[model samples]
Target: MRRPRYYTPTEVSLHNTIDDLWVSYLGRVYNLTPLVEEYKGNILLKPIIENAGKDISHWFDPETKDIRTHIDPISRCVKYYTPRGRFVHVPPPCPRSDWVNDFGKPWWRDGRFEVGLLTAKTRWIRIINTLTSQEQMLEVCSEDTLDEILQCYLYYNSHAASYTWKYDGVNLDMSKTLSENGIPDKDEEFYQCLMDRDLYTESICLYFNDDLSEI
Candidate 1:
């Protein structure tokens, strides 16, 4: 048997449109294009369409009443319709094969629609500046863009207080990964040193910073 391939969030974000819909559940990626086609006219299809190309594990929990309400009616309903003077029972919109197990695992175990695994773990990092003794933390993922990280930092740090703070390890390049710029993993739990460009001295410290611009 071949090992399952892993996919980054960046790759998953590319398939956000309805035509190429995909979603992740419990770290498993599923291409939902066929499901979209099958449930086109069904009311139950609305949620699936709304959350295309996103992680929907939270939406499909077995214990949640939302999933039960959305799926149970469609899964159990058998309506009779007259066609050509003959009454025929119309099957539910949800295909039997698409039914999920207790853990929300799909019944169709075929590898064809199984795209890849969500590999990166999201972590919240606490950053402290040695020079100012100021600290802050933000949630980030390994696949997050440099600009996204910076925006998060700015959003959290931006307040009534103003200080000309420079991210020591990060450079002008906003395309590189934090890991590439020397930001330690969450497990490291070590304080990183920050530098003041004007001071030319290693007086500041930060938990994580990327030096992509310097590269």
Candidate 2:
């Protein structure tokens, strides 16, 4: 058996189009492109389309009576649909056996279209101004690079032009990974980085003056 692949929420969000729909439910990612194409105009299609490229756990959650009632028909459809009546042989009701193991938990269990696991959640990091002690939290993903984080901060804080960032007393190297720079693991609530004086003043001046060497 092949090992299961894992994907981040951001990775799954990229497949939001009708031709490449994906959704996360109970930490599992499902690629519903084939089903979406097969049931394009069916009544069951609405919820899938509405929740495409997003998590739908709350919709069919076992504790929720409202969405559960709504999903019952979709589950029954999956259990009984026959494709074009070619009748060579009946394919299993659901593609995967685990899906068929439980009928009442959620309709997602009735569809055997899982793609991978949703492994990463958005993390918030605190970027503190060392000079003024002012702090701001920024949302980022595990796959984001230091450069991307810096760019986000710069975009949000206009005063970033006057400051640079430091992690654990060292200058934040834009080329480094967040993990490499000691950013905490997932759900940490708040990881901190210090804002320091920008040391690139001379380099910026030289670059503007057409000095490629300093760049």
Candidate 3:
């Protein structure tokens, strides 16, 4: 049996109007807020909104050290940020100081581009969570959870509507040029464009027809 929620549906809506008057942290400015905003319009917001309260606040609030913190790492697995202002996987490589001198690693060779926040934070947070005696603190997600995180990352990143294409052969249609040059099976039907006049003459003559005695 559950006691009545003080903020019922009607009360919640009215309170929402009042809450709107308060600084929203996300008022119209996209960059000013965290990635959590993009999640609000989602269908999942219903359950989350319904449950959000003073209790949930303690979770997200830095000072509370609530149980929500442990779950937050898992809940937020899908989205994270990079230091460059780009949202990527793994937090951006630590600032140069933290990388070579402080952390002592060749972070550059690690392909620092895919760096994101969730996984990186998980590494340190797990240690703290384990050593801490508090049971309410947030726990880190397991390695197996990375795939799901990546899936969510891709879904959110894929929303961009525009794209760019290279202009290599827009005018001349260089399919034949590519096939004849070095592309595999250019002589067959796949890249018939590679079999064009200038291509065949240029590539075929340059290599196969050249004098072998010089070799």
lDDT of 1: 0.52
Runs in model 2 lying further than 4 Å from the true structure: 62-107, 120-215
Which residue segments of model 3 deviate by more than 4 Å? 1-13, 17-41, 51-55, 64-67, 71-215
Per-candidate local distance difference test: 0.52, 0.57, 0.24
lDDT of 3 by residue, 144-191 (tens): 132232222233333211111112222212222222223223234434
TM-score of each: 0.39, 0.42, 0.16
Reference-based lDDT, residue 89, model 1 = 20
The sequence of per-residue lDDT tens digits that candidate 1 reaches over residues 1-215 is 95455566665767877688887876778887876665567665566667777876664444431222232344465432222221112233446874434533332244567787786675455555554577665556666655555556665554212222324644324565556655545343332344332232122134333432321
- What TM-score does candidate 1 reach? 0.39
Candidate structures ordered by TM-score, highest first: 2, 1, 3
lDDT of 2 at 46: 67
**TM-score winner among the candidates?**
2
